[model samples]
Target: MEKEFNGRDLKLGQIQDGNSDYTRYHITYKSGDLTISGIMNIPKGIPPEDGWPVLFLNHGHIDTSVYTNGRGLRREQDYLARQGFAVLHSDYRNHTQSDKDPNTETDVRLGYVEDVINAVMAVKNSDISSLSKERFGMLGHSMGGGISQAVMVVRPDLVDAIVLYAPVSSDVVDSYNRWTLRNSSNAEKIRSAHGSPEENPEFWKNMSPRTFFDRVKTPIIIFHGTADESCDIEWSRETRELLLAAGKRVELVEYPGQYHEFGATFDDFMKRSSDFFKNNLK
Candidate 1:
């Protein structure tokens, strides 16, 4: 938690074909020693007085072997950019062409949280005149939701608002046991490195965002489907309950019969998310 992140040498390159409302660019920034890749979408119109509000887009877990640059969160990026927010979608280290982090899996994805924090710092340290310094929001889906939670607790000053779409448990151990333990040998790998959650309660608690909810500054809104098979709706319910108990501003919007990927309800959630960023980021 005390580590310093120098999000320096941010370079925006290669303007790509974009929708009518925005322009897209490939971007790279320094997260520690590794060069991280991402995409930035800037709205086509003029900027506000304080400049355009920034949204850091955190995507769900993808197999790193198959992941490419700017591979995830395409719809959210387009909708948010079209809504006049400057969106930055980072492909966390060890994914795509970005440099690898050897400790990523064994350390339980904390490196991802660090990369995200650095992405925010990169914006702050950049010479991008169109981006806002104050009004920074975050949108995370599934595994991305978990990363955003850690980011909130670790760097409370960075985000103005947060939208968690079908997030995993704030407790990383739950996610580990649910996915890792049931599916593969990774459970033993992680346990051998950090010890099991039961065996090393202090270590696990220190890493889980649930342990540090009091440090969160952003107003959190979680959207979950009642029938989400990938990520149980109960996870979001527990998150909202914990946040409320911590005296933080939080709300959970449940969608009945909606799945994890939000098929019919995608536009609805996007509209609600636009409203949230508008009210908070403005």
Candidate 2:
């Protein structure tokens, strides 16, 4: 049975001042029955006349065994916060301090997408008068990029712009097939619990961003490394093509030989993302 979502308010709480130009808070927001936890980075100086714009940060997949509270994109979050944007990074359910779920293949890990969307809603409706409820953007890496695409399809007005880094394919079925190639037994279990991709195409279709490209209205900038092994660079290229064909605003920035994590090119990636948000969100 699908759980009921009420889009409840966030119980904002400040954990620390960050001891820098940005203040850090530990946020707890209601996402269904479970309360999710994340770090919110707020600029310490005076707020703009219209309040500070928000940037939702979504991270890539990390092994649960070694994942920490701010695993995938902590550095990127810090950089964004320093750039004068309020950044929120969720731990996501079953990863760190958040709740758990019985996720399956056809579902395509939309739970993480829900967690991110709920977090955005929480910030928009929170009592923090200094944060802008109107202006919002997104930065997603790897699997998080896929989540951002899905979110854009469902909530076109939620974010004004998005930045992606080496994202997975918009096709959830293809992503699941990649997973199955590495772990056949686990893939079979997920398929048995849900239905195989061939038998339950609709389920996969509903979970994929590719199925609803026409609904994506926000402008997006994609950064992909040609040498990336985890997520194929071709996926982002194809997604860019689809979005363009649908008449949506899209741009793809390529890195010649960088890997999935971007390693030495991390700083360049950050600058491009920061610039994109600055230009679009304003």
The best candidate by TM-score is 1
lDDT of each: 0.90, 0.83
Candidate 2, run of 10 with poorest lDDT: 1-10
TM-score, one value per model? 0.97, 0.93
For candidate 2, write residues 98-214 as lDDT tens digits: 777766233557788888888888877788888988889998998899889888888888899999888989998778878664777777776776687798888778778988999
Clashing residue pairs, backbone N/CA/C < 3 A, model 1: none
Give the least accurate 10-residue stretch of model 1, judged by summed lDDT.
Answer: 180-189
At residue 280, give the lDDT of candidate 1.
87
